[model samples]
Target: MTKTRRIPFVVANWKINKLQSEIAEFLDNVNSKVPSQTVVETGIAAQDLFLADMVRATQDSPIHIVAENVHWEDAGAYTGETSPRALKDIGATYVLIGHFERRKFFNENDSTVNLKVMAALRNGLRPIIDVDEDMSKYAQFMDAEPSVAQVASALAGVSVDQIRNITIAYEPTWAIGSGEAATSEQAQKAAHLIRQTLAKLYSPVIAEQVRILYGGSVTPDNASALLQQPDIDGVLVGTAALDPVKFLELINIAKQPSMPGQFDTDEV
Candidate 1:
């Protein structure tokens, strides 16, 4: 049986942005602003320094709190790193791994990402693994290693059931922070490719069970077009996510009914 979550996920990747004071004000109005007409599994990814505040702010609300990233190890001599235990303690239900920026700036390759994914699962945290092709071509990374490899590597030893806890966010390096989002067709193509790769690595059922979200320059203007794509389960929002009004609009856009052929087809 296909175990794909198939739920519409609207996630906010606050990244390294957002101040404690700004977060406090936003969370105050977010719960009341969420539209009741449509349902979208929404979450906010706060910077490490602000996760606790974000978590506390969202308590008793329908929104879920997410952490930008976390170390793979639960505990040890790894200095200056927050343990998965720490995230759970702070009430972070999800974590991000393998974002293009992390790989570029921190030299985090697929191996470390695999470790992080397993670690997040081990600690009861659902992970949003980012797998995006480096479009800059300045590094020639796409030729060196496709994003698909990163996805496969992250799930190397994860069991079928464990895979369901993972949300694959396909954010290409080019589209992010550029203020220029990919056309809906382009985003869907990448989402489909990722799902197809999952089928090859595991089973069609597990592949379908995995949720895929598109990221990079996701604004309210384009969220509906992207969410309408058959395989696109949701979004890993960036710039617009920092604003409460825009973020709620984006979530409402995702709430709109998806077209037919979104899932029942054979081709990814």
Candidate 2:
């Protein structure tokens, strides 16, 4: 990776937490802590109610605003649903599509994930397509990680340019919020598989350009170890992301130099 290469990306997935006021406070705290010497890109994936609040708070800050979820269609009679256009209009430049919770609780599948991905791109919002493993299939994952089929499906028919602008988060279902996170090596294997799938889907150039993030029990303590991995470009923090101070600590950790000579690596 060169100086002009893809910069490290960090996202805070607030899920169902935070009041509008609290979101403002968190962003204020975070914006203050981001050192002037570093270059880590940051974003907050808050719920629908707080998207505007987050966007307004970070308007002048370097932090990008992201929505936690989105509806596939731009408009219709889908009550209580959020449209990609609405999110973009609200100043959110990114949306989290097909997260594990949506998959498990709301019954989201690859097909819908694809729909949301295209919708986000068309509406000018970058899609953070999440690929997670099902815990029941844990041991089988000893050989298979976030399945190539899963990633390929989410990106089905996506073009190279759009692919380059996108982000993929590999959050193994078993490790998320369970206090038992995947080891850096385990996360690397999964990220490698994702990048491999991307290369095959389009081309090596775009594949390497796409950022693959790890999202599973990420904390300030373990963030540096994970960020230093060759394939891992960033993280999608969950519980820990709720705290502005701790989350900023993780961002600072990401800014620390990747282990000496560790990232002098390329696609396998």
Candidate 3:
């Protein structure tokens, strides 16, 4: 695959944790310290209740507020579901559609995931579509059929123009919250397959342009190796992101220059 200059993105999926008071404290600690988005894009995903507040708190910072999930319809009788339109209106720039937890706990399937992806796009919210691959099966074939299929299904009917606004995250189910992260080589292999899938669905140029992130148990100690992988543009962190200090550390790590051959690019 040819190289491209995709900015590194470090996002924290707070995922149903933190109180209002704790949220305020966390923001106060990291908001002023965050690097400019141009250097390293940063985001924090939290419960729906805290999205608006988080948006306001980070207004002066580069930290983009991300929604964990959004309903397909702009507005409906769907009780307890977040409206994509409302989320956009409330200043959420990004939304996490088809997260592992949402799929595991709330029965989110590929069909529903596609709906949410389209809905988020329709409402001007960029969807960070999560594709959870079961890595234990990775060795059977390097093609990564399940992960590739998930990407195709989630992007069904999405247009080329809209595709630029989307980001794909590969969070292997086995590593998520298990305190074990994929080896750098393993993460790179999965990310490469996802990118290749994009090349087939869209175009090789578009595939290189899209930023793919690695998630599941990412931390400062292990993040550098993962980030240096040619295909991994950034990370979708979980527990480690809960702490303001660790969160800042992750951003700083992303801001560092890539090692030689880590990024091979010519102007797209």
Estimate TM-scores for all models. 0.89, 0.90, 0.93
Candidate 2 lDDT at 65 equals: 85
Candidate 3 clash figure, as a count = 0
Compared with the true structure, what per-residue lDDT tens digits does model 3 show for residues 1-268?
Answer: 4545678999999988999999999999999999988778999999999899999998999999999999999998999999999999999999999888889999999999999999999999999999996544545656643347789999999998899899999998989999999999999888888887888898777777788999999999999999999889899999999999999999999988762213545434
Candidate 2, residue 243: lDDT:
88
Residue runs of model 1 more than 4 Å from their true location after superposition: 1-5, 35-38, 134-147, 259-268
Instruction: Put down candidate 2 lDDT per residue, 51-91, tens digits, no spaces.
Output: 78777776668888888899999999999999999998989
User: Which residue runs does candidate 2 get wrong by more than 4 Å?
Assistant: 1-4, 35-38, 134-147, 259-268
lDDT head-to-head 2 vs 3, winner: 3
As a whole number from 0 to 100, the lDDT of residue 31 in candidate 1 is 81
* Pairs that clash in candidate 3: none
lDDT of 1 by residue, 1-268 (tens): 2222366888998888867888888888688776542356899988888888777777777788888778989999998887998999889999998899999899999999999999899999999999886433323332232336678888999987788799999898888999999888888877777787788777766787778999999999988888888878899998899999998898878777663223542322
Give each model's whole-structure lDDT: 0.81, 0.81, 0.89
